[model samples]
Target: MEKKHTIAITVEDQPGVFTRIAGLFARRSFNIDTITVGKSEKQGISKMIITVIGDDRDLERVEKQINKLIDTIKVTEMPKKSAFIAELCIIKVAVQDKKIRDDIFSYAKIYDAKIIGMTDKTLTMYLVGESENIESYIRLMVPFGINEISRTGVTAISKDW
Candidate 1:
């Protein structure tokens, strides 16, 4: 059976690191569901969070392959129950009228979405939470007309428990 897996990698902070990692996935014919890269806690290193769907056995093999890469310092598959995963999303929606705008604002309040920008006809909001919550918010906003959406792919950190 196939299942979703979140893999966290610690790699050297150097050019082409992402390209090499992406190429590895491509060569293996594995689809990356989501990926996020940023500076890690240690200097001269970076952290990459990648989500993929594949069989457990195949994923284990992929992890070993990734670990063999030159720039990779460590690779670990984070279990959902043992990690806190979240994504950041920014959505712009059209404000048709006062009632529509008010409704949007109300929904935003309920979802804890912060209004970051506004214009006579548009509202831009920033939301950070689980992907499911963000999807639900987008669903609710569809009727009001979404202008655009940009999301920082899922990022995760291991829980202390």
Candidate 2:
């Protein structure tokens, strides 16, 4: 069965780290849904969070291959029940009138989306939470006028295993 997997990797902060990791996935023919890299708590190290969809066997193989990479300090596969997943998204919607703008505000309030910017005709909002929530919020905004949408895909941390 295919399902989503959350992977966290601690790696040396050096050039081509991401390229090599991405290359590995490509060579293995794995499809990545999202990958986010940021400075880790430990200096000189970077943490990468990757989300992929695969069967148990394929995921296991990928994890083993990732661990063999020299730059990789650690590779952790997060259990669905033990992971806290989130994504950050910024959406811009066009609102040409007061009623439409107010309606957008109502929706934002319900979703806990913050209005980060606004023009007479456009509203820019920032939302951070589960990918499902963000995606659903986007869907609700679609009928109004989705001008632009950018997302920092699934970044997750595991609860103590």
Candidate 3:
């Protein structure tokens, strides 16, 4: 049975490194659910948090392949129970009437989402939370009509030692 897996990878910061990693995924036929990369604490190195869906054997094979890459320094699987995971979502919802606007604002407050911007016709909200919370908030706004959504896919780190 397949399951979701989040892998944290540390690699040397260099051109073509992302391409190589992406190519590896494509070649192996693994679909990446989300990938977030940024500079790590160490200079000249970068970290990537990638989420994928596959069985244990498949995940093992992919990790081994990633470790073979020249730029790869370390690859570690972050189990949800042992990781602090989050995703960011920016959503613009249509504000058609006073009641709708009030309702939307109320829902945002309930979810602790920030109202980043607003105009006569729309309200833009910024929310950062677990994937499930993000999805739930989006669902609540559907009745109000969503104008646009931009999500920074899952980024995570291991829990405290």
List CA RMSD, all candidates: 1.0, 1.1, 0.9
- At residue 86, candidate 2 shows an lDDT of 92
Ranking by lDDT: 1, 3, 2
Q: What are the models' TM-scores?
A: 0.96, 0.96, 0.97
Candidate lDDT scores, in order, read: 0.94, 0.93, 0.94
lDDT tens per residue, model 3, 84-160: 99999999999988999899888989999999998999999899999999999999999889999999999988999
- Residue 65, model 2: lDDT of 90
Clash totals, every prediction: 0, 0, 0
Best by TM-score: 3
Q: If both were scored by lDDT, which would come out higher, candidate 1 or candidate 2? A: 1
**Over 4 Å off in model 3, which ranges?**
none
- Model 2, span 78-153: residue lDDT tens: 7768889899999999999999999999999999999999999899999999988998999999999999999998
**Model 1 off-target regions past 4 Å?**
none
Candidate 1, number of clashes: 0
